[model samples]
Target: MIKNFLNKLPKKQVKSAESRDGGSLALSSNASTTSRINSASGARSGNVNSLENNSTQNSGVNHGNKLHDPLRSKANGSSPPVPYEALPGFRDVPSAEKQNLFIRKLSMCCVVFDFTDPTKHLNEKDVKRQTLVELVDYVSSANGKFSDVVLQEIVRVVSTNLFRTLSTQPRENKVLEGLDVEEEEPLMDPAWPHLQIVYEFLLRFVTSPETDAKLAKRYVDHSFILRLLDLFDSEDPREREYLKTVLHRIYGKFMVHRPFIRKTINNIFYRFIFETEKHNGIAELLEILGSIINGFALPLKEEHKLFLVRALIPLHKPKCIPMYHQQLTYSITQFVEKDCKLADTVIRGLLKYWPITNSSKEVMFLGELEEVLEATQPPEFQRCMVPLFRQIGRCMSSSHFQVG
Candidate 1:
């Protein structure tokens, strides 16, 4: 009978009740909290409990209004943006309603402000900042699975904030002939305040127990991974650090994406080696690759061997090797360690790129060769030792004291 009466609530009467009595919505929210409290306490016999139950029973009209808000909004999505003061937060909202509230927050954040001009939307900017913090905390402590809609909302909001075209590099960042990176100031992102929080939220969400890989795969797919890889070029080291960790996490958890990640990174290397010769995150990428190369199975697959020969070895030819030489040396050494037989191939590759004209590069190559030789067994050493000793003789004859 109660169900029949609720089914019979005419839309006009429901709207009229909510329109004339503004307190009904707040009453409904408070009544929900009170009923939850009373039921959890097991207070079944008291008049207070009876009164709470009656109150819950009377809020049906207000509940209908909550249900009606969605339909009305859909009827007019072209409505101007919600005022900054009217934006909702997840705090104190019922757990069951948090998902909807989360969507609203994401929608509001989708409107990217011109962070370059601080004079714009001061209050609104702070509101979004606070909203992002709440979101980060909510994702961190969330106990249940994220709904599909929530996952899409996350990607949309993140894409809006993270995937913009970064400004051009300062002249200080260019590859000057003699200036060290320490001589110049670093280019930091102006919007890092909000960017950092969003990055944190994404990192936690990716690693969260509630994020099922199967569902997450839908939004965090190949195109998503590609765009993320592009972020490795960001001039801001802090943002690239976040990208490095997040991409590493994605590569680890999303098993289906593994092969593609390797291939795409190889493409990045190919471009860096052959085309652009300029990228900010080469060291970070190689850092991630060091961990990955460590995990490669023994008697390695031909594909892995090809990567070592084609990409890792050629990484030595870049003018910027000094920038990433440590990581490059580690990755190359990992390849040789997995199969000592590759030491000969690696030694020959190193010798092929040895710099006679550039004394500093000759010194770096000598250091890398020392580390590689430490892992080289007798058999592989014999294969390349003849030319290797020849290079040592050449280095000893060099006019540069360091090479000698």
Candidate 2:
């Protein structure tokens, strides 16, 4: 029976069941770092020198006019001056103008990057770097005359590729000739802006009061998050940290500042938790779920409360759990307190639909529920509790005889 039950179970479901029902566990938000684990990890390559060189080359060229631009590279004179010499957008620019544009735009993104990162506590010795200070000036004024499109492109390019790669580079390595018998494992990377700052900017832009649907469509794509998830699963510690940090912030933003984002987050998590069936990832996922609860449980909207309540149903099955029920019990306890009215409604509704609980297991499960509630009741309700205890006692007496 045990083997058969395990066979039908998916990891996320099992974890949800185990944790939601009463399983004792403290899930971590950090991605699993075991090097041997088959989780997400990888990176894309873009050479800094090549990009810089291309930018440098574009700065110095100035085409006179599109119709008769003499500065245009002469297509092999042999071939009737090829109609289009250079590509459309790369026509021409003043060297000084281009350099100023690059620096000005690059500097502005520095502000965007800072804005995205949450302000961290700094020590007395922590000096504010000059570059950081300079960034503030650029972003503040560079876009005054420029279009939002121009500002966005600048933010996208400069922010996306930079600082992401450093997350995964291994620090300590064996000195091949040292001939030491033992090797030391390196410390885990510090989590911060592991993902590109563009993600934060895109999210901010999307939620802005003046958000333009057309413009937002161009930059903010949910698919990017899927790729991030894939990278996180690659067993690369750096990628893991990056993905974790990004998701954490995204989740925080949704729960705190953007309640509208809850739908999107729930959709993303559902895909991972249900559609993907990647059960081994349950522990970390539970942490994410816990964070969601911590942030939104208080003063939850009725609609949201119902949504959360329904979401927990899939987690109640025995098939999802392999052992203890402490995690599930604790989570339910939190939900009960946060959404007492809704929880009561749910428990009453469940009792109504519960197909005749004649089995010993059902009786015991109901009995445990009663016991938990009774234990948590206040002394002031001690008199009222007597009736509840009496009713439960009657149910147990009858249930015991039927089971026997």
Scored against the true structure, residue 135 in model 2 reaches a CA lDDT of 30
The global Cα lDDT (0 to 1) of model 1 is: 0.68
Encode model 1's per-residue lDDT on 1-404: one tens digit a residue.
22222232222211101111111111111122223223322222222223212222110011212221211111121222445543555666887888888888876666555444434455656666667767776786788998898998888878776776767753333445431344444465556656766776787788788999899999999988888898888776667766766776676677777788889999999999999778888998988777677777656888888999999999998887788998899889988888899999999999999886888778888899999999999999999989999999998998889899
Model 1 segments beyond 4 Å from truth? Answer: 1-82, 170-182
TM-score of 1: 0.78
Against the true structure, whose lDDT is highest? Answer: 1
Instruction: Report the lDDT tens digits of candidate 2 across residue range 114-206.
Output: 212123311100111222222323332233243456545543543342223332443332323212213443233222222222332333333
Q: Each candidate's TM vs. the true structure? A: 0.78, 0.37
Q: What C-alpha lDDT, on a 0 to 100 scale, does residue 162 get in candidate 2?
A: 29
